[model samples]
Target: MICYFSGTGNSMWVAQTVSERFRDNRLTDMADAVVSSNNLNFSLTEDERLGFVFPVHSWGIPWIVRKFINRMTIDNYSNQLIYCILTCGDDSGLTNKMLLKLFRRKGWQCRHIYSVQMPNTYVVFPGFDADPAELEQKKTAEAVPTLEKIMAAIVSDSPIDCYLQKGQQFLKSRIIYPLFCRFAMSSKPFRTTDKCIGCGVCVKNCPTHNIRLENGRPVWANNCTQCLSCLHRCPQTAIEYGKESIGKGRYYYGKRKDSQQ
Candidate 1:
């Protein structure tokens, strides 16, 4: 079983690519898998390999993914080999290490952790503008060959167990993560314009389902994941986090060639 959490579809694409190489594979988005507070369903046999795919945020796992992992109930699977694939915009140093430690605490024997680079979608960073169409093309071209190698590695059952030892060292010395979180959480909220068509595409694409329509305008709920799916998917360009997002280019995982009403 391959369980994934994707905000803007980078991790989704990676999960789909990896699942295509296996038989009897089960692919599930984390949001759809977790319903009630106490009940969760993961259809995996004792012999099946369990895989998790997700994007790294704030040098760690997304808060929702962390919560899901903590709440998951799985027993009687002694031979399960857990593998994790982390998709990131740049270096994923130390992120995998922290995840492995967390999984160890949960009694899961993690066999492998792989990091892959996807197009950077965190547009709030300084000088972070890129042509969305060109970036997608470049990512597709780069991902095909990289994914092929990953598939081959999986088939051969190779050992790829290099940990991010430097992450701990850097975190202790620089205090960078704390500063980043402070800034990220303090950013101004996004607002919707009158031009919003209320098609609900942004609501559907939000990983955290943070956006809701109020009086026909999009309103961000409190528990936002800050994955930027809503701001990027607005067809009318009606969503804006601040003046910064205004007039900035938008991106989508799949081609936007389809017509919009």
Candidate 2:
């Protein structure tokens, strides 16, 4: 089974690509699992490998992903090969270590870990915006080779160790990540502009279901994980995260005609 939580489609693309590599595989969306009342339980077949794919948030995992992990339960007893794929805009701090600790607590051994750099989708903070067209194309293009390596590692019998593009582990993960979780995540700044046409795109694309239509405009709830899917996916480009995103560019993984596998 492959469990994933994607905000702006980068991780979703990775998850889907990996799932297609196998003839028989199950795909679960962690965000949907969290919102659903169904129990987070699954029985892995002997031949099926367990995998987790998600985007790196603030150099760490998203709050929704953490919540899902806390409630998740795998029924099978034997230790199957568990793998992880993390998609990031730049670097994933010690997010892999944090995930490993979570797995250990759940009595699961993670055999392989891989991180892929995708186009930047986070643009709420100052000095952070979507990558330029060339850079975005380059990152997406480069991800193909990295994903190929991940697929190869997953099928291998020998245990594949972790490989992470962890930059400033102590500062980003230990210090900055905690701070970001505490203070950075909120939906207060989300608001629709005059350009908003009551399209309901944001409401539908929100992974956490944090947006809703009210009087022909979108209203944000407190459950937002700051995924920026609503802001990036808006067709009119009318959503803004306060003044910081006023003139900033938006980005979400859109498959191009010439995109390579």
Instruction: Point to the candidate with the largest TM-score.
Output: 2
Per-residue C-alpha lDDT of model 1 across residues 27-104, encoded as one tens digit per residue: 767755553245653546767888888887756676667777877767666757778888776556566767777888
RMSD in Å for all candidates: 3.4, 2.3
- Cα lDDT of model 1 overall? 0.70
Q: What is the lDDT of residue 162 in candidate 2?
A: 37
Candidate 2: 10-residue stretch with minimal lDDT = 157-166
lDDT of 2 by residue, 112-206 (tens): 87798899888888889889989998999999988887788788745454355645789989899999999988789888889999989999999
* Candidate 1 RMSD computed on C-alpha atoms after optimal superposition onto the true structure: 3.4
- Model 1, residue 88: distance off in Å is 1.3
Residue range with the least summed lDDT across 10 consecutive positions in model 1: 160-169
Q: Tell me the lDDT of candidate 2.
A: 0.86
Candidate 2 lDDT at 139 equals 91
What residue runs in model 1 are displaced by over 4 Å at the alpha carbon?
Answer: 34-37, 41-43, 131-135, 161-174, 178-188, 256-261
Question: How many clashes show up per model?
Answer: 0, 0
Question: So what's the TM-score on candidate 2?
Answer: 0.94
